[model samples]
Target: MATFNVRPDIDAAVAKLSSTVGTKREIQHLPEVLWEGETVEMLATGVYGKGNGLLVMTNQRLVFYFHGVMSQKVEDFPYRSVSSVQWSGGMLMGTLTVFASGNKAEIKQVPKDQGKALADLLRQRISEATSAPTQAAPAAAPAGDIASRLATLDQLRAAGAITDEEYRDRRTKILDSL
Candidate 1:
Protein backbone atom coordinates (compact mmCIF):
# COMPACT_ATOMS: atom_id res chain seq x y z
CA MET A 1 0.00 0.00 0.00
CA ALA A 2 1.33 3.40 -0.94
CA THR A 3 0.40 6.53 0.95
CA PHE A 4 1.03 9.75 -0.92
CA ASN A 5 1.57 12.81 1.19
CA VAL A 6 -0.91 15.38 -0.07
CA ARG A 7 0.97 18.45 -1.29
CA PRO A 8 -0.15 22.04 -1.46
CA ASP A 9 -0.22 21.63 -5.27
CA ILE A 10 -3.19 19.26 -4.94
CA ASP A 11 -5.21 21.82 -6.90
CA ALA A 12 -3.01 21.22 -9.96
CA ALA A 13 -3.64 17.50 -9.76
CA VAL A 14 -7.35 18.12 -9.51
CA ALA A 15 -7.24 20.30 -12.64
CA LYS A 16 -5.32 17.71 -14.64
CA LEU A 17 -7.59 14.92 -13.54
CA SER A 18 -10.70 16.90 -14.43
CA SER A 19 -9.24 17.70 -17.84
CA THR A 20 -8.47 14.05 -18.49
CA VAL A 21 -11.99 13.07 -17.57
CA GLY A 22 -13.59 15.84 -19.65
CA THR A 23 -15.60 17.07 -16.71
CA LYS A 24 -15.61 20.39 -14.92
CA ARG A 25 -14.17 20.16 -11.45
CA GLU A 26 -15.32 22.44 -8.68
CA ILE A 27 -13.13 23.02 -5.65
CA GLN A 28 -14.94 24.74 -2.84
CA HIS A 29 -12.87 26.43 -0.20
CA LEU A 30 -15.16 26.24 2.74
CA PRO A 31 -15.66 29.61 4.32
CA GLU A 32 -15.87 30.02 8.06
CA VAL A 33 -19.57 29.96 8.83
CA LEU A 34 -20.71 31.07 12.28
CA TRP A 35 -23.24 28.57 13.52
CA GLU A 36 -24.60 29.03 17.04
CA GLY A 37 -21.60 31.21 17.89
CA GLU A 38 -19.12 28.57 16.77
CA THR A 39 -16.80 29.16 13.81
CA VAL A 40 -16.95 26.21 11.42
CA GLU A 41 -14.46 25.79 8.63
CA MET A 42 -13.93 23.02 6.09
CA LEU A 43 -10.38 21.71 6.43
CA ALA A 44 -10.29 19.70 3.22
CA THR A 45 -12.02 20.40 -0.08
CA GLY A 46 -12.57 18.67 -3.44
CA VAL A 47 -11.87 15.08 -4.40
CA TYR A 48 -8.54 13.33 -4.28
CA GLY A 49 -6.74 10.04 -4.88
CA LYS A 50 -7.77 7.63 -7.69
CA GLY A 51 -11.56 8.06 -7.63
CA ASN A 52 -12.50 11.76 -7.33
CA GLY A 53 -14.50 11.12 -4.21
CA LEU A 54 -15.70 13.93 -1.97
CA LEU A 55 -13.34 14.95 0.82
CA VAL A 56 -14.23 17.03 3.83
CA MET A 57 -12.16 18.18 6.76
CA THR A 58 -12.74 20.10 9.97
CA ASN A 59 -10.30 21.55 12.44
CA GLN A 60 -9.26 18.19 13.88
CA ARG A 61 -10.68 15.65 11.45
CA LEU A 62 -10.44 14.54 7.83
CA VAL A 63 -13.29 12.64 6.21
CA PHE A 64 -13.49 10.65 2.98
CA TYR A 65 -16.97 10.55 1.58
CA PHE A 66 -18.02 7.33 -0.10
CA HIS A 67 -21.22 6.22 -1.76
CA GLY A 68 -23.76 4.08 0.07
CA VAL A 69 -27.32 3.45 -0.98
CA MET A 70 -28.25 3.80 2.66
CA SER A 71 -27.27 7.07 4.31
CA GLN A 72 -24.75 6.51 7.09
CA LYS A 73 -22.19 8.70 8.85
CA VAL A 74 -19.83 5.72 8.88
CA GLU A 75 -19.84 5.97 5.11
CA ASP A 76 -17.30 8.70 5.72
CA PHE A 77 -14.18 8.21 7.83
CA PRO A 78 -11.07 10.08 8.85
CA TYR A 79 -8.07 9.83 6.57
CA ARG A 80 -5.56 12.14 8.21
CA SER A 81 -2.52 10.87 10.03
CA VAL A 82 -3.10 7.57 8.31
CA SER A 83 -0.42 5.04 9.12
CA SER A 84 -1.51 2.50 6.52
CA VAL A 85 -3.75 2.56 3.45
CA GLN A 86 -4.95 -0.04 0.96
CA TRP A 87 -7.38 -0.16 -1.93
CA SER A 88 -9.75 -3.09 -2.07
CA GLY A 89 -12.86 -4.02 -4.01
CA GLY A 90 -13.17 -0.52 -5.48
CA MET A 91 -12.95 1.01 -2.04
CA LEU A 92 -10.24 2.65 0.00
CA MET A 93 -9.63 1.18 3.45
CA GLY A 94 -7.03 2.13 5.95
CA THR A 95 -6.01 2.55 9.55
CA LEU A 96 -5.74 6.11 10.73
CA THR A 97 -3.15 6.86 13.37
CA VAL A 98 -3.87 9.86 15.52
CA PHE A 99 -1.58 11.42 18.09
CA ALA A 100 -2.46 13.89 20.81
CA SER A 101 -0.39 14.79 23.86
CA GLY A 102 2.10 12.08 22.84
CA ASN A 103 -0.66 9.47 22.86
CA LYS A 104 -1.75 7.55 19.76
CA ALA A 105 -5.03 5.99 18.68
CA GLU A 106 -6.01 3.75 15.76
CA ILE A 107 -9.19 4.04 13.77
CA LYS A 108 -10.02 1.53 11.07
CA GLN A 109 -12.28 1.95 8.07
CA VAL A 110 -15.59 0.19 8.28
CA PRO A 111 -15.68 -2.72 5.80
CA LYS A 112 -17.76 -2.22 2.64
CA ASP A 113 -20.34 -4.84 3.57
CA GLN A 114 -20.42 -3.50 7.08
CA GLY A 115 -20.65 0.00 5.71
CA LYS A 116 -24.29 -0.69 4.85
CA ALA A 117 -24.91 -2.18 8.26
CA LEU A 118 -23.12 0.71 9.87
CA ALA A 119 -25.28 3.08 7.86
CA ASP A 120 -28.41 1.31 8.97
CA LEU A 121 -27.25 1.42 12.58
CA LEU A 122 -26.43 5.10 12.32
CA ARG A 123 -29.80 5.75 10.73
CA GLN A 124 -31.48 4.03 13.63
CA ARG A 125 -29.42 6.02 16.11
CA ILE A 126 -30.29 9.27 14.41
CA SER A 127 -33.92 8.35 14.16
CA GLU A 128 -33.95 7.54 17.85
CA ALA A 129 -32.07 10.70 18.73
CA THR A 130 -34.42 12.93 16.75
CA SER A 131 -37.67 11.19 17.62
CA ALA A 132 -39.74 13.04 20.19
CA PRO A 133 -42.22 11.26 22.41
CA THR A 134 -45.56 11.12 20.69
CA GLN A 135 -48.24 13.32 22.16
CA ALA A 136 -51.92 13.17 21.31
CA ALA A 137 -53.14 16.06 19.19
CA PRO A 138 -56.73 17.24 18.84
CA ALA A 139 -58.72 15.93 15.92
CA ALA A 140 -59.54 18.29 13.07
CA ALA A 141 -63.10 18.83 12.07
CA PRO A 142 -63.84 17.65 8.53
CA ALA A 143 -63.29 20.44 6.05
CA GLY A 144 -64.41 20.72 2.42
CA ASP A 145 -61.96 19.84 -0.40
CA ILE A 146 -58.29 18.75 -0.23
CA ALA A 147 -56.99 22.24 0.51
CA SER A 148 -59.45 22.64 3.36
CA ARG A 149 -58.69 19.17 4.61
CA LEU A 150 -54.98 19.95 4.73
CA ALA A 151 -55.60 23.21 6.47
CA THR A 152 -57.89 21.52 8.93
CA LEU A 153 -55.30 18.86 9.57
CA ASP A 154 -52.65 21.48 10.21
CA GLN A 155 -54.95 23.37 12.50
CA LEU A 156 -56.02 20.22 14.27
CA ARG A 157 -52.45 19.14 14.86
CA ALA A 158 -51.50 22.60 16.06
CA ALA A 159 -54.50 22.78 18.33
CA GLY A 160 -53.99 19.31 19.82
CA ALA A 161 -57.03 17.93 18.03
CA ILE A 162 -55.15 14.90 16.68
CA THR A 163 -52.06 12.90 17.52
CA ASP A 164 -48.98 13.23 15.36
CA GLU A 165 -49.43 9.67 14.15
CA GLU A 166 -53.06 10.34 13.22
CA TYR A 167 -52.13 13.54 11.48
CA ARG A 168 -49.38 11.85 9.48
CA ASP A 169 -51.50 8.84 8.51
CA ARG A 170 -54.51 10.93 7.52
CA ARG A 171 -52.34 13.32 5.56
CA THR A 172 -50.70 10.44 3.68
CA LYS A 173 -54.03 8.86 2.82
CA ILE A 174 -55.44 12.17 1.64
CA LEU A 175 -52.37 12.90 -0.49
CA ASP A 176 -52.44 9.40 -1.94
CA SER A 177 -56.06 9.72 -2.98
CA LEU A 178 -55.22 12.88 -4.86
Candidate 2:
Protein backbone atom coordinates (compact mmCIF):
# COMPACT_ATOMS: atom_id res chain seq x y z
CA MET A 1 0.00 0.00 0.00
CA ALA A 2 1.12 3.55 -0.69
CA THR A 3 1.82 5.91 2.16
CA PHE A 4 -0.67 8.74 2.41
CA ASN A 5 0.57 11.78 4.26
CA VAL A 6 -1.56 13.10 7.10
CA ARG A 7 -1.05 16.55 5.71
CA PRO A 8 -2.75 17.45 2.44
CA ASP A 9 -0.44 16.65 -0.44
CA ILE A 10 -2.35 17.16 -3.67
CA ASP A 11 0.42 15.92 -5.91
CA ALA A 12 0.83 12.74 -3.90
CA ALA A 13 -2.91 12.20 -3.86
CA VAL A 14 -3.17 12.65 -7.60
CA ALA A 15 -0.25 10.41 -8.30
CA LYS A 16 -1.63 7.72 -6.04
CA LEU A 17 -5.04 7.84 -7.65
CA SER A 18 -3.57 7.69 -11.11
CA SER A 19 -2.10 4.31 -10.32
CA THR A 20 -5.31 2.97 -8.77
CA VAL A 21 -8.35 1.55 -10.55
CA GLY A 22 -10.75 4.43 -11.07
CA THR A 23 -11.87 7.15 -13.38
CA LYS A 24 -9.61 10.18 -13.65
CA ARG A 25 -12.41 12.48 -14.70
CA GLU A 26 -13.43 13.27 -11.15
CA ILE A 27 -9.88 13.71 -9.94
CA GLN A 28 -9.95 17.26 -11.21
CA HIS A 29 -12.55 18.19 -8.60
CA LEU A 30 -10.77 16.71 -5.60
CA PRO A 31 -8.65 19.76 -4.82
CA GLU A 32 -11.77 21.81 -4.39
CA VAL A 33 -13.60 19.43 -2.00
CA LEU A 34 -10.93 17.74 0.07
CA TRP A 35 -10.58 19.12 3.57
CA GLU A 36 -7.35 20.57 4.80
CA GLY A 37 -4.99 17.90 6.17
CA GLU A 38 -7.06 15.06 4.73
CA THR A 39 -5.17 12.28 2.93
CA VAL A 40 -6.72 10.03 0.32
CA GLU A 41 -6.08 6.35 1.02
CA MET A 42 -8.23 4.63 -1.60
CA LEU A 43 -10.44 5.43 -4.57
CA ALA A 44 -13.06 3.45 -6.56
CA THR A 45 -15.56 4.23 -9.27
CA GLY A 46 -19.15 3.55 -8.27
CA VAL A 47 -22.72 4.72 -8.40
CA TYR A 48 -24.31 6.52 -5.51
CA GLY A 49 -28.05 6.70 -6.01
CA LYS A 50 -28.46 7.64 -9.64
CA GLY A 51 -25.13 9.28 -10.21
CA ASN A 52 -21.82 7.75 -11.13
CA GLY A 53 -19.02 9.03 -8.89
CA LEU A 54 -15.77 8.25 -7.22
CA LEU A 55 -15.81 6.81 -3.72
CA VAL A 56 -12.77 8.10 -1.87
CA MET A 57 -11.52 6.89 1.46
CA THR A 58 -9.36 9.47 3.12
CA ASN A 59 -7.51 9.63 6.42
CA GLN A 60 -10.38 11.57 7.91
CA ARG A 61 -13.46 10.68 5.91
CA LEU A 62 -15.16 8.70 3.12
CA VAL A 63 -16.27 10.88 0.25
CA PHE A 64 -18.41 10.36 -2.84
CA TYR A 65 -18.32 13.08 -5.43
CA PHE A 66 -19.99 13.34 -8.82
CA HIS A 67 -19.89 16.08 -11.40
CA GLY A 68 -22.31 15.86 -14.26
CA VAL A 69 -23.34 18.16 -17.02
CA MET A 70 -26.33 19.40 -15.05
CA SER A 71 -25.41 18.92 -11.42
CA GLN A 72 -22.76 18.07 -8.87
CA LYS A 73 -22.95 16.22 -5.56
CA VAL A 74 -20.40 15.73 -2.85
CA GLU A 75 -21.10 13.57 0.17
CA ASP A 76 -18.64 12.99 2.96
CA PHE A 77 -18.83 10.69 5.98
CA PRO A 78 -16.35 11.34 8.75
CA TYR A 79 -14.63 8.25 10.10
CA ARG A 80 -15.91 8.89 13.59
CA SER A 81 -19.42 9.12 12.26
CA VAL A 82 -19.20 5.86 10.39
CA SER A 83 -20.82 3.13 12.46
CA SER A 84 -20.06 0.29 10.06
CA VAL A 85 -18.95 -0.53 6.55
CA GLN A 86 -19.59 -3.62 4.43
CA TRP A 87 -18.36 -4.76 1.06
CA SER A 88 -19.77 -7.41 -1.28
CA GLY A 89 -18.33 -8.24 -4.65
CA GLY A 90 -19.95 -10.13 -7.52
CA MET A 91 -18.35 -11.39 -10.69
CA LEU A 92 -17.84 -8.01 -12.26
CA MET A 93 -19.00 -5.44 -9.71
CA GLY A 94 -19.12 -4.73 -6.00
CA THR A 95 -21.20 -2.82 -3.48
CA LEU A 96 -20.05 -0.78 -0.53
CA THR A 97 -22.47 0.24 2.16
CA VAL A 98 -21.75 2.68 4.92
CA PHE A 99 -23.88 3.05 8.02
CA ALA A 100 -23.62 6.27 10.01
CA SER A 101 -25.87 8.00 12.49
CA GLY A 102 -28.94 5.97 11.62
CA ASN A 103 -28.42 6.70 7.93
CA LYS A 104 -27.17 4.36 5.26
CA ALA A 105 -25.27 5.21 2.09
CA GLU A 106 -24.64 2.57 -0.50
CA ILE A 107 -22.33 2.78 -3.45
CA LYS A 108 -22.73 0.17 -6.15
CA GLN A 109 -20.81 -0.84 -9.24
CA VAL A 110 -17.49 -0.45 -7.47
CA PRO A 111 -14.58 -2.13 -9.21
CA LYS A 112 -14.60 -5.72 -7.98
CA ASP A 113 -10.95 -5.85 -7.00
CA GLN A 114 -11.01 -2.57 -5.12
CA GLY A 115 -14.12 -3.09 -3.01
CA LYS A 116 -12.87 -5.34 -0.24
CA ALA A 117 -9.65 -3.39 0.15
CA LEU A 118 -11.50 -0.11 0.48
CA ALA A 119 -13.97 -1.56 2.94
CA ASP A 120 -11.24 -3.07 5.05
CA LEU A 121 -9.33 0.20 5.10
CA LEU A 122 -12.46 2.07 6.08
CA ARG A 123 -13.11 -0.40 8.88
CA GLN A 124 -9.56 0.02 10.12
CA ARG A 125 -9.90 3.79 10.12
CA ILE A 126 -13.19 3.57 11.97
CA SER A 127 -11.73 1.23 14.55
CA GLU A 128 -8.79 3.55 15.11
CA ALA A 129 -11.03 6.56 15.37
CA THR A 130 -13.51 5.01 17.78
CA SER A 131 -11.21 3.09 20.07
CA ALA A 132 -10.21 5.01 23.16
CA PRO A 133 -6.55 5.13 24.10
CA THR A 134 -5.96 2.34 26.58
CA GLN A 135 -2.64 3.54 27.99
CA ALA A 136 -0.61 6.60 28.85
CA ALA A 137 1.39 8.42 26.23
CA PRO A 138 4.33 6.44 24.92
CA ALA A 139 5.88 9.83 24.31
CA ALA A 140 6.44 9.98 28.06
CA ALA A 141 8.39 6.72 27.96
CA PRO A 142 11.72 8.60 27.85
CA ALA A 143 13.49 9.72 24.69
CA GLY A 144 15.89 6.80 24.81
CA ASP A 145 12.97 4.37 24.90
CA ILE A 146 11.57 5.48 21.54
CA ALA A 147 13.82 3.20 19.53
CA SER A 148 13.01 0.20 21.67
CA ARG A 149 9.29 0.92 21.51
CA LEU A 150 9.44 1.14 17.73
CA ALA A 151 11.36 -2.09 17.63
CA THR A 152 8.74 -3.78 19.76
CA LEU A 153 6.05 -2.46 17.48
CA ASP A 154 7.87 -3.85 14.48
CA GLN A 155 8.24 -7.16 16.23
CA LEU A 156 4.53 -7.21 16.92
CA ARG A 157 3.93 -6.76 13.20
CA ALA A 158 6.38 -9.49 12.38
CA ALA A 159 4.64 -11.77 14.85
CA GLY A 160 1.22 -11.02 13.34
CA ALA A 161 -0.11 -9.23 16.40
CA ILE A 162 -0.90 -6.12 14.36
CA THR A 163 -1.50 -5.44 10.70
CA ASP A 164 0.99 -3.52 8.59
CA GLU A 165 -1.32 -0.53 8.44
CA GLU A 166 -1.66 -0.52 12.21
CA TYR A 167 2.09 -0.70 12.60
CA ARG A 168 2.63 2.18 10.25
CA ASP A 169 0.03 4.32 11.96
CA ARG A 170 1.40 3.65 15.43
CA ARG A 171 4.93 4.22 14.22
CA THR A 172 3.94 7.50 12.63
CA LYS A 173 2.27 8.66 15.81
CA ILE A 174 5.31 7.78 17.84
CA LEU A 175 7.63 9.65 15.48
CA ASP A 176 5.38 12.67 15.21
CA SER A 177 5.37 13.18 18.95
CA LEU A 178 9.13 13.47 18.94
Candidate 3:
Protein backbone atom coordinates (compact mmCIF):
# COMPACT_ATOMS: atom_id res chain seq x y z
CA MET A 1 0.00 0.00 0.00
CA ALA A 2 1.15 3.53 -0.76
CA THR A 3 0.89 5.81 2.23
CA PHE A 4 1.31 9.56 2.37
CA ASN A 5 1.79 11.80 5.36
CA VAL A 6 -0.40 14.76 6.24
CA ARG A 7 1.29 17.81 7.67
CA PRO A 8 1.22 18.18 11.41
CA ASP A 9 -0.17 21.72 11.17
CA ILE A 10 -2.99 20.54 8.94
CA ASP A 11 -3.73 17.68 11.29
CA ALA A 12 -3.88 20.18 14.15
CA ALA A 13 -6.24 22.44 12.24
CA VAL A 14 -8.50 19.53 11.33
CA ALA A 15 -8.50 18.37 14.91
CA LYS A 16 -9.42 21.87 16.03
CA LEU A 17 -12.31 22.03 13.61
CA SER A 18 -13.44 18.51 14.43
CA SER A 19 -14.28 19.53 17.98
CA THR A 20 -17.47 21.10 16.64
CA VAL A 21 -17.50 19.63 13.16
CA GLY A 22 -17.19 16.01 14.27
CA THR A 23 -14.61 13.51 13.10
CA LYS A 24 -15.17 12.99 9.44
CA ARG A 25 -12.22 11.13 7.97
CA GLU A 26 -12.95 12.51 4.51
CA ILE A 27 -12.95 16.07 5.76
CA GLN A 28 -9.58 15.56 7.40
CA HIS A 29 -8.18 14.30 4.13
CA LEU A 30 -9.78 16.92 1.89
CA PRO A 31 -6.96 19.43 1.91
CA GLU A 32 -4.51 16.79 0.87
CA VAL A 33 -6.54 15.95 -2.21
CA LEU A 34 -7.73 19.45 -3.12
CA TRP A 35 -4.29 20.96 -2.77
CA GLU A 36 -2.12 18.13 -3.97
CA GLY A 37 1.38 19.29 -4.90
CA GLU A 38 0.49 22.75 -3.52
CA THR A 39 1.46 24.33 -0.27
CA VAL A 40 -1.06 24.74 2.54
CA GLU A 41 0.02 28.20 3.58
CA MET A 42 -2.36 28.99 6.42
CA LEU A 43 -5.32 27.73 8.38
CA ALA A 44 -7.68 30.02 10.26
CA THR A 45 -10.78 29.39 12.32
CA GLY A 46 -13.81 31.52 13.28
CA VAL A 47 -14.75 32.32 9.73
CA TYR A 48 -18.15 34.05 9.45
CA GLY A 49 -19.17 33.42 5.89
CA LYS A 50 -21.08 30.42 4.52
CA GLY A 51 -21.90 29.27 8.00
CA ASN A 52 -18.60 29.79 9.81
CA GLY A 53 -16.24 26.92 9.08
CA LEU A 54 -12.48 26.50 8.85
CA LEU A 55 -10.63 28.45 6.15
CA VAL A 56 -7.76 26.75 4.35
CA MET A 57 -5.30 28.78 2.31
CA THR A 58 -2.97 27.14 -0.16
CA ASN A 59 -0.48 28.46 -2.66
CA GLN A 60 -2.97 27.84 -5.47
CA ARG A 61 -6.36 28.50 -3.88
CA LEU A 62 -8.30 29.46 -0.82
CA VAL A 63 -10.76 26.76 0.26
CA PHE A 64 -13.34 27.08 3.01
CA TYR A 65 -15.04 24.03 4.44
CA PHE A 66 -18.18 24.18 6.58
CA HIS A 67 -19.73 21.24 8.30
CA GLY A 68 -23.01 20.95 10.10
CA VAL A 69 -24.43 18.03 12.05
CA MET A 70 -25.31 16.28 8.80
CA SER A 71 -24.30 18.59 5.99
CA GLN A 72 -21.02 19.69 4.47
CA LYS A 73 -20.13 22.31 1.90
CA VAL A 74 -17.01 23.84 0.46
CA GLU A 75 -16.07 26.91 -1.52
CA ASP A 76 -12.88 27.35 -3.49
CA PHE A 77 -11.33 30.59 -4.69
CA PRO A 78 -8.30 30.32 -6.92
CA TYR A 79 -5.45 32.75 -6.25
CA ARG A 80 -5.31 33.90 -9.83
CA SER A 81 -8.90 35.06 -9.69
CA VAL A 82 -8.54 36.92 -6.42
CA SER A 83 -8.61 40.71 -6.84
CA SER A 84 -8.54 41.99 -3.28
CA VAL A 85 -7.51 40.78 0.13
CA GLN A 86 -8.26 42.99 3.14
CA TRP A 87 -7.61 42.69 6.84
CA SER A 88 -9.75 44.32 9.48
CA GLY A 89 -11.17 44.03 13.02
CA GLY A 90 -9.37 44.68 16.30
CA MET A 91 -6.31 43.29 18.03
CA LEU A 92 -8.29 40.66 19.89
CA MET A 93 -10.44 39.55 16.96
CA GLY A 94 -9.24 39.85 13.41
CA THR A 95 -11.16 39.44 10.17
CA LEU A 96 -9.95 38.56 6.70
CA THR A 97 -11.93 39.55 3.64
CA VAL A 98 -11.15 38.05 0.25
CA PHE A 99 -12.66 39.14 -3.04
CA ALA A 100 -12.18 36.82 -5.96
CA SER A 101 -13.98 36.40 -9.25
CA GLY A 102 -16.72 38.75 -8.03
CA ASN A 103 -17.40 36.63 -4.94
CA LYS A 104 -16.70 38.00 -1.50
CA ALA A 105 -16.03 35.93 1.61
CA GLU A 106 -15.51 37.58 4.99
CA ILE A 107 -13.85 35.46 7.63
CA LYS A 108 -14.46 37.29 10.87
CA GLN A 109 -13.23 36.95 14.41
CA VAL A 110 -10.11 34.97 13.52
CA PRO A 111 -7.31 34.42 16.01
CA LYS A 112 -4.64 37.11 15.93
CA ASP A 113 -1.72 34.82 15.15
CA GLN A 114 -3.24 33.36 11.99
CA GLY A 115 -5.05 36.49 10.83
CA LYS A 116 -2.05 38.72 10.27
CA ALA A 117 -0.03 36.01 8.60
CA LEU A 118 -2.94 35.10 6.33
CA ALA A 119 -3.44 38.70 5.33
CA ASP A 120 0.23 39.15 4.49
CA LEU A 121 0.35 35.97 2.47
CA LEU A 122 -2.85 36.77 0.61
CA ARG A 123 -1.65 40.25 -0.24
CA GLN A 124 1.62 38.91 -1.58
CA ARG A 125 -0.13 36.26 -3.69
CA ILE A 126 -2.69 38.72 -5.00
CA SER A 127 0.07 41.15 -5.90
CA GLU A 128 1.99 38.48 -7.74
CA ALA A 129 -1.12 37.33 -9.62
CA THR A 130 -1.96 40.89 -10.53
CA SER A 131 1.46 41.82 -11.86
CA ALA A 132 2.03 38.67 -13.86
CA PRO A 133 -0.34 38.37 -16.82
CA THR A 134 0.29 34.66 -17.34
CA GLN A 135 -0.69 33.79 -13.81
CA ALA A 136 -3.30 36.51 -13.40
CA ALA A 137 -5.97 34.70 -15.36
CA PRO A 138 -7.18 31.81 -13.27
CA ALA A 139 -8.92 28.99 -15.00
CA ALA A 140 -12.69 29.36 -15.17
CA ALA A 141 -14.59 27.43 -12.55
CA PRO A 142 -16.53 24.42 -13.79
CA ALA A 143 -20.22 24.70 -14.65
CA GLY A 144 -21.17 22.59 -11.68
CA ASP A 145 -19.19 24.92 -9.47
CA ILE A 146 -21.22 27.88 -10.68
CA ALA A 147 -24.44 25.96 -10.09
CA SER A 148 -23.48 25.18 -6.53
CA ARG A 149 -22.65 28.84 -5.88
CA LEU A 150 -26.02 29.89 -7.23
CA ALA A 151 -27.61 27.35 -4.93
CA THR A 152 -25.80 28.84 -1.96
CA LEU A 153 -27.06 32.31 -2.82
CA ASP A 154 -30.55 30.91 -3.12
CA GLN A 155 -30.24 29.32 0.29
CA LEU A 156 -29.09 32.60 1.80
CA ARG A 157 -32.14 34.30 0.33
CA ALA A 158 -34.53 31.54 1.39
CA ALA A 159 -33.22 31.80 4.93
CA GLY A 160 -33.91 35.56 4.84
CA ALA A 161 -30.29 36.46 5.53
CA ILE A 162 -30.31 38.47 2.33
CA THR A 163 -32.97 40.43 0.49
CA ASP A 164 -34.39 39.33 -2.85
CA GLU A 165 -32.45 42.12 -4.49
CA GLU A 166 -29.24 40.93 -2.96
CA TYR A 167 -29.83 37.37 -4.12
CA ARG A 168 -30.57 38.51 -7.66
CA ASP A 169 -27.50 40.70 -7.72
CA ARG A 170 -25.19 37.97 -6.46
CA ARG A 171 -26.70 35.37 -8.71
CA THR A 172 -26.23 37.63 -11.71
CA LYS A 173 -22.64 38.28 -10.80
CA ILE A 174 -21.85 34.58 -10.38
CA LEU A 175 -23.40 33.77 -13.70
CA ASP A 176 -21.65 36.62 -15.45
CA SER A 177 -18.29 35.28 -14.40
CA LEU A 178 -18.89 32.01 -16.26
For residues 52-108, what per-residue lDDT tens digits would candidate 3 score against the true structure?
666777778777777666767687777766767888869677888887655677888
User: Which segments of model 1 are wrong by more than 4 Å?
Assistant: 1-51, 55-114, 139-149, 152-168, 172-178
lDDT of 1 at 67: 32
**In model 3, what lDDT does residue 146 have?**
88
Q: Rate the local accuracy (lDDT) of all candidates.
A: 0.38, 0.76, 0.68
Candidate 2 C-alpha lDDT tens digits along 89-123: 99988899998755789999887777777898899
Give the least accurate 10-residue stretch of model 2, judged by summed lDDT.
1-10
Number of backbone-clashing residue pairs for each candidate, in the order shown: 10, 0, 0
Clashing pairs in 2: none
Off by over 4 Å in 2: 1-22, 134-178
Name the runs in model 3 displaced over 4 angstroms. Answer: 1-5, 8-27, 133-178
**Clashing residue pairs in candidate 1, if any?**
43-57, 137-160, 137-161, 137-162, 137-163, 138-160, 138-161, 138-162, 139-161, 139-162
| Reference-based TM-score, model 3 | 0.58
Best by lDDT: 2
Q: Could you arrange the candidates by lDDT from highest to lowest?
A: 2, 3, 1
